[model samples]
Target chain A: MRQLIVFTLAILVSTTFKVYSQEIRIVNYDQLDKLVSSTKDSVVVVNFWATTCKPCLEELPYFAEAGKVNKNEPVKFLFVSMDFTSKKEKAAEVFSKYNLPGKCVLLSENPNNWINKFNPQWGGDIPYTFLQDKKGNRTHYPKTFATSEELINLIKKELIKQ
Target chain B: MKHLLAILFLFIVSISIAQTTGYKPGDKAIDFSLKNIDGKNVSLKNYNDAKGYIVVFTCNHCPYAKAYESRIEELNQKYASKGYPVIAINPNDPVAYPEDSYENMQKNAAEKHFTFPYLLDETQNVAKTYGALKTPHVYILKKVNNELIVKYVGAIDDNTESAKDVKKKYAENALNELLQDKTVKEPETKAIGCGIKWKKN
Candidate 1:
């Protein structure tokens, strides 16, 4: 009887470990919609990045740090990786390697139309950023990564307006 | 009648000078000695036996270029034997992205077994001269009557990812046109690639 119980316990532990280790699939547009809707009271910071883009890689840590610092606040950070489908698995490896945080997701959509759907102001550039307030008022900053101070000031200004 | 003839002559001279801003169709491309991955000079004039050149602006790290690496190699293999060889140039500032560093360029070349010379544009002068905006951008030139004239300038194809989905092959068609002495059907097209990471001011 004790052997049976031990086996069962081991099975449960291994199952839970497997579940936790599974890579999260964030390609669903529905998930993104839900995130935006639920975080309506807070500001949403969306950063478009890719595993191969060096500027995107450099700026991601700043967003991660920003999320941690604002853990007690109402800011919702999303790191949308723009890596191609062919590189999806590779991107996952890179994400784990970097120990990325703050809701990492791989963008899944027809890439040709993605830029227009996201923001017309965006020039289809990597490391692009979009900020949305609780009211759904959106502002797109279509460029490379921002310095910590630049990021902080932008957030502070948004918070002040709120 | 004499005054009208002089005016016509002056207008022709003005048009000729305006057309010489850089290389155009039917212009002999001036050769330049540029450093390659091995720190050795590679010049267009080196291929004395070649009929023309295919100058492509590409780099080691851009996703678009990475996607088209094999296809570009295929082009070099197919055409180099036919006389028009590919001469690739890396125009991105190495300071902005270390992977674009000359060291990484050599590494990428060896690892990928690149068939053509991958030259570095030290000052981005060549890129500026050609108005190349993105990686994998192509400029096909041919020597017609001893003048290096631009045959075509654009993306390799309409689809950067795959030929299966390609609606058109710009470079291939241009080469075919050049071979037949016919005007390229599509002379220019936009390319999608990583933006050249210029050093921040």
Candidate 2:
């Protein structure tokens, strides 16, 4: 009976770990659009980043920190990875390494098809961030967030807006 | 006082916006004299026999640039003889990414067997002048009466994943139309790429 209980516990732990690591969903632009636009009561913070982008990697911790700081707020953080579908495993590793809060998805579509849909003015630069308030007002940041404070302040400002 | 502050804010915003705006299609591209990997300075004016140029702003570090590397080589192979030789430039600040340094760029070009002139935009002036925001960004220019007229600006194709699966060859289409002396249908396109690492302000 003791052996069986220990075996069961080990299997449960392994499965849980596997699930946690595999949590990143591979999504196309339509599904991503649904995820971003469906939240009516929360401000959606979407960060487009890639594992290969140096500045993007540097700024990941800031987003992670901001997500934790704003956990109770009506804010949803979505990390939309712009990595190739083949590099999903690498992206997943980074996702788990950061232990990032909120949902993480790998956008598998070629960006040219949907870049204009997100923002016509965006010149397809990575580390780009999109913030959509509850009222559907959108803000686009085409550069890196230098610090967690900067990211958190942006979220706070959006939360209090009408 | 509030009215004065508001006007000042508007003025600052306008200045910043103007600074960010870069060359559009049909604008005359400025020629640059940047150092080539061969230790010689190359400029658009030196290629007098060329009909146009496929100026690519790429780097050694970005995966997006790596993915398009072979395709860029192929573009030179196909078009160099047709008078549109590829002039690849490394515009990223080496301080941010060591792989983009001049020495590494030279090594990368040699290792990859790059046939085209791979130049270094040391001060990043050429990149800023052209308004290149990211690596693998292309500016296809056509020489018109000794002036480099920007014809098409954008990605190499519609697909970044696999060249075989590409549906629209954006750059190729523009090149074909230009070669035939016809107007380019798509003047501008946008693709996700690594942002050019600018020098610290």
Candidate 3:
């Protein structure tokens, strides 16, 4: 009876760990550039996120699910985390804790540089997403988070624009 | 031509209203007299002939502000020599974010070797005047034909958390455009940081 209980507990712990460890990865600037360049033909969805941002965490699963649904399509999803260098470990832990998916990269530059590059008027607010079509028309959807329907609609719109 | 005229008209109107209300592009910034770390006084009017001014709302405690401390210093160093001096202001209510207290501000400025005046807006009137809603919020102003026309308002950069994946430099771009007498492509951006810790109303 004791052996059975121990075996059940071990299985549950291992299962939880295995399920959660597949979510977050930290890539450098070169990796990010490569990702962006590689997805030139597809509608690139880049979502800016941070661990401290509650809405970012709340809305992450929807993006993972969206990535799954569009796996066969010419759409690529990139989750660019704005977590500070000091909190990389914490961000990684949270990623495992939340089981986030899609290609995740930790942003390593100052906020002032990219806010305007993305949209000269962006204020470095996150969970902001920048969606672009093949025609080079880019739409910056800077919001707290998007519902699954909202995400789907945006993806569909980008695909249509292509 | 019509668009130019409309912009000119809007610019004049925005300037007139900014004195008593919201800050918009082309507005002549109002003068401010705020106490410095050593109880010294500082004012925008003192630099009446300055080519431009970079008024940055920052504090001692915010992680976002801390992330750009060196960059802010670098900006001040780069521009102050070119006549665009930076004025760092602490607008957080001490009661709320205790780390923003005057004492801590002094310590942080000293520790960071800040070259600019770390002005303390005791009444926070200067912050309210500028509608500065967050730490690290920046306002770049230029003396266009002797009128203090605002050239830029927003974040200091794109990536505050990390400096590796940054794509554009907003403050620098605004400064360069102003120097060349060209319109700033991006004038204003949303200010993101720890929300202003105003004295609870």
Candidate 4:
């Protein structure tokens, strides 16, 4: 009886840990495209950030809060990390530490080849947020520090217009 | 009426912010006197004898900037004698990022043995005027008949990760073209680097 109880407790703990530990998806451009195109008639907030960027860290919580607030809304938040492939572990650790909401993925694409694809005028800087509509058409791509309210308002404006 | 005025004011502010998205190719470079690491003020006008200038907006803490430090030094070593001297500047706010402070700039200049004038853009006007979005951003300005012309604006090369892997030396090529009295083939290119730490309003 004692052995059975111990085995059951161990099994429960392992399962709980496995469920709680969210795996950070390491994705190429093709995978990123798939994720961006997954949902229809939804406002997607694709935030390009990294562990090394201080401004990114400062605003990420606010961004997470925005995601949580708009959970029921026709909004989808994607935290795409621009950290190097070598810092995959570090990026994952930061993601967990921040408890960043929604789908979290590390983009492994070489920026030189794809920076302009996202936006022609994009200078490949962090703390950049790309707000897109249901059809994957970009509504706003602010390449600077943006507050949660500003992000939400942008989304709302787009949603109303569309 | 008050609400309408507030909305109008907000609209104007937004318009101004949109206007600051920064300099494109062919825009005349804004000249300013920024303090160099050597405790002397430097300006584009000071380089009257030079044919052109390789203005690089970079900082200490940025890994990409550090990566290109050697290449920047070599650029100065080769070009400063050849009329197109490298003029590096730190356009980041020190309070937002302490590593970008003037003192750190001096230390970095000494430690790295930089041959060019490493200036501190305290106001960041020069950087904004040039549309410098990231560290290690380059703007190759040519001196033509006492007027400065923005010949090229872009990255030092295609690869910022490794200097050896650089296939296209964009800035170098532009300078070479200028030296040969020819038009620069590519006017602008983008690079991946740390964003310039702007001070809060």
Query: Predictions ranked by TM-score, top down?
Result: 2, 4, 1, 3
Candidate 2 chain B, run of 10 with poorest lDDT: B14-23
Q: Against the hidden reference, what TM-scores do the models get?
A: 0.63, 0.91, 0.59, 0.83
Give the per-residue lDDT of model 4 (tens digit) for B35-123. 99989999988886899889999999887788899999999998889899999999999998899999999999999899899999998
TM-score of 2: 0.91
- Flag the better candidate by lDDT, 1 or 4: 4
Off by over 4 Å in 4: A1-31, A108-112, A143-147, A156-162, B1-21
User: Which residue segments of model 3 deviate by more than 4 Å?
Assistant: A1-82, A85-88, A91-162, B1-21
Please, what are the lDDT tens digits per residue for candidate 1 over residues B41-134? 9988789888888898889879878888888888999999888899999999998878888999999999999999999998876775665656
lDDT value for model 2: 0.90
* TM-score for chain A, candidates 1 onward in order: 0.79, 0.87, 0.73, 0.82
- Highest DockQ, which number? 2
Candidate 2 colliding pairs: none
Candidate 1 has an fnat equal to: 0.14
**Chain B TM, cand. 4:** 0.90
Q: Model 1: DockQ against the native?
A: 0.13
lDDT for each residue of candidate 2 in B1-201, tens digit (9 for 90 to 100): 999999999999986774586678999999989999989999988987899999999999998899899999999999999999999999999999999999999899999999999999989988888889999999999999988999999899988878889899999999999999999999899899999988987
In the range A51-127, model 3's lDDT, one tens digit per residue, is 76555777888787777778788887777877776787777777656544455678765444444454654545456
